[model samples]
Every structure is written in structure tokens, then in C-alpha cells.
Target: MGSTASDEDYFQRGNLFWFTVITLSFGYYTWVVFWPQSIPYQSLGPLGPFTQYLVDHHHTFLHSGYWIAWLIHVGESLYAMVLCKSKGITDSRAQLLWFLQTFLFGIASLSILMAYRPKRQKRT
Candidate 1:
């Protein structure tokens, strides 16, 4: 008997470009929140005007945005866990990976779960 790609115990890697973009965005948010003064806000090119306004006048709003972003990611991760369970991905490691990835990458991970169509065996 041969095992196909569906038979493999793993999750989809998802879109690489989106993953990189999101990871960089999360890192940038962290930097903006933690070290606002250290950032060359004016030299951020097209991002300068908006970023400077947030850092200079709306710092509290910026902090709220950071927390809200993370809260949304947490909500998405919980949804990913539910989606995995419904999809029959009962393996603990796979579920954990899904949760972590969804938490970190948000929709990048959830989109794959949304597209997944599990293969089912016919019983005689």
C-alpha cells in the first residue's frame, strides 16, 4: 500500500510571502511599541507621516492598537484549533503547531485550514 500526500501527518505550510510579511509586521509593531524613541520615525519613508503622528500625539492609541492586534490573533488561533478538530487533525503535535502558527501568523495559517479537504476512506 502507498501513502499519498494526504496520508502524511502534517499541516499545510501556507503562503510564504504572507508569512514573511506578517512576521515582519509583528516585529515592527513590537519595535514601535517598545522603543518608540529609538526608531527613526521621520526616516521611515512613506510610513513616516502616519507613524510619526501615532508616536508623537497618539501613543496611547498606538498601544491600544498593538494589544488589539494580538487579541485578534489569539481569537484566530482559538478558531484554528476548532477548525483542526473539525477537520480530524486530532494529533496533539499537529494541533499545537496549528495553534501556535495561527497565533503568530493569523490568517496565513487559518486560510490553509479553511481550504483543506480531508480524504475519507470508504467502509465495506
Candidate 2:
């Protein structure tokens, strides 16, 4: 079989996107649930959707990590949909929310990765 546009030459680049998101979202989710200090709910507001999700799913979220992880997981899925679109994996089909979600996540992922990269010093 021949390669399709969606097959994509930028798989590594795209995967980097996914890895970054999964890592950050999953990490944040874990921390938020287990260590609310990981990301202060004050910023997003405890009454926000994620916190509400945590409260609603009290049984499974008994532990901070699981609840937080789930929150991240939902966000990431939405992210992945857009990642697919922006990367040309597929047409976004005029879906505003999908496009917005993908675009936001992609931008955030890149920004977070840039922020977290270790700085290097010249060894002259």
C-alpha cells in the first residue's frame, strides 16, 4: 500500500505532541488529585469542571492521583482530536470545539515543553 497524507511524514513530531500532552496532563492530573498543590485550584477555581468531576466521581477519586489522572485523561482525549486535525491527519470538518481544543492543547503542549527544557551552557 502507498502512503496516505494522514500516514504523515511528521509522525515523530506529532508523537512528540502526544507524548508531551500525555505527560503533562497525566502528571498534572496525578498531582491535582493527590497533591492539590501540584496546580493550585485557585487558578482554575475549585468550582471548575475538573474539580466538579473529582467531586462527582468521589468513589474512584478517593485517591488524588486517580481523580486527577482522569481529569487529565478527558482533557487529553479532546486534545488528541485536534492534534490530529492540525497535523493534517484529518480534516477538522468545521467542528469549532474540536478545532479549538486541538489548537489550545497543541499550543499549550509546545509552550510547556519549551518552558521545561533544560538550558545548556557552552563548554568553551
Candidate 3:
């Protein structure tokens, strides 16, 4: 089947949204991991207490990082559900699998879907 203009627009917008999400997630992770010293600890907002606790007690920055990664995973899982629906994936098992994979693997699961997605067929 041929894609209509609206369908193409929807596809482009979805792609752009996913790309933006992934880029921002990666950028935040990189900044936290590589240049954390550049971050102003005093202005960490809600994370200030946790950051101080971890620094003063544990002497490590891992707890905050773990929380951030967990938050990202949760967001990815929610996005996976929306993605499965948008892609017309009706099989319950398939949707569940993708959701779990996306939660566990993040953008890797999205890449897998893009790589293996079936091509649209032409109408006779």
C-alpha cells in the first residue's frame, strides 16, 4: 500500500521525536559521567540532598547516576509502548517483548525495530 501524505508526516514526526529523546538522553548521560565536575552541585535542585549524602557518606557518585539511569529506563519503556502501538503491532506477546527489551536495552531495541521493520507494499 502506498503511504499518503499524512502517513509520511506522521512517520517523520515520530522519527524526529525519538531522535530528539535519544540525543538528549545520551547527552545528559555523557555530561554526568565525563564532566560532572563542571556541574554546579549547589544548584542540583531535588537531587542536592541525595548528592550531598552520597558524597559525604559513600564518597561515590554512583547512587545519583543509578537513579538517573533508572528514570531513563522507565521513560524508554513508556515510549516503547507508544511506539508499538504507532507501528500497528497488535500481537500482545510482541508488544510485551518489545516493551521489556526497550526498558532493558533502551535505544538498542529501537534500532532493532528500525532495522527489521517490514517495508510497505505497493497497491496493485
Give a tens-digit lDDT track for model 1, residues 1-124: 1123542244777678999999898898888888988888768898977877778898888899999999999999999887877776766777888899899999889988777776852222
Angstrom error of the Cα, residue 24, model 2: value is 0.8
TM-score of 1: 0.85
Q: Give the alpha-carbon lDDT of every model.
A: 0.79, 0.46, 0.58
The residue-by-residue lDDT of candidate 3 on 10-42, one tens digit each, is: 221224566567767667556555666665677
| Candidate 1 vs 3: which has more TM-score | 1
RMSD of 3: 9.7
Candidate 1: segments with Cα more than 4 A from true spot: 1-8, 121-124
- Candidate 2 lDDT, 7-108, residue by residue in tens: 222222234666677667656655655565444455676545676467456735447556564566466556655454444433334234333443444444
Model 2, C-alpha of 58: deviation from truth (Å): 1.7
Give the better candidate number (2 or 3) by TM-score. 3
User: Candidate 2 clashing pairs?
Assistant: 29-68, 33-64, 34-64
- TM-score per candidate, chains pooled: 0.85, 0.32, 0.46
The number of clashing residue pairs in model 2 is 3
**Model 2 reaches what TM-score against the true structure?**
0.32
The reply for model 2, stretches above 4 Å from the true place, is 1-14, 45-49, 52-59, 62-124
